[model samples]
Target: MSNMVKIAMTSDLSPGTGTTIEMEDQSIALFNVEGNFYAIADTCTHRGGSLGEGRLNGDIVTCPKHGAHFNVKTGEVTFPPARFGVKTFPVTIEGDDVLITLD
Candidate 1:
């Protein structure tokens, strides 16, 4: 079975914001869309830019380095210069805490 780790609480993330976290040698980006939480790889597929520091427009996140856009909900590349998609993790909310399943 895959192990689930508690990354942060709901209060830790505000709406339309994201945070970068290091877990088990992996860099993960935690996003708060509206009130729901989503997790994705922090590194951009096109370049080694930080996705968490990028701009959040609705569900789409734009890379600040090369302007590569990605959908946080699906982790799909939506813009050019980024042909590959980043890895996305399953996120669950337990009460006021946010948890992620990493495999």
Candidate 2:
């Protein structure tokens, strides 16, 4: 099993916003929609844009590079110039810390 690594404090993220965490060999994007938190691959499937730097409207993220939209919670492609979906990661909250388990 993969170990869960703490990436950021819960206070560090806000509703309708996103952040990036680079761990070992992975780049993860974290999103807070209201009080719920979700995570996904930070790289946009549609041309490698930084999804963490993308715009967030609800749980949908518009890729900064090419306007591809993805669901942060599901990593599903909602609108895209590219057909594939990025990977989604599981997130958990421990006190004020946000943790991710990557495999």
Candidate 2 Cα misplacement greater than 4 A, ranges: none
For candidate 1, the 10 contiguous residues with the lowest summed lDDT are 45-54
lDDT of 1 at 36: 85
Local lDDT at 39 for model 1: 92
Candidate 1 regions with alpha-carbon error over 4 angstroms = none
Best by the TM-score measure:
1
Model 2 clashing residue pairs (backbone)? none
Tell me the TM-score of each prediction against the true structure: 0.97, 0.95
Task: Compose the digit string of candidate 2's lDDT tens values, residues 14-43.
Answer: 898998888888888989889788889999
lDDT of each: 0.92, 0.89
Q: Return the clash pairs for model 1, or none.
A: none
lDDT (0-100) at residue 43 of candidate 2? 93
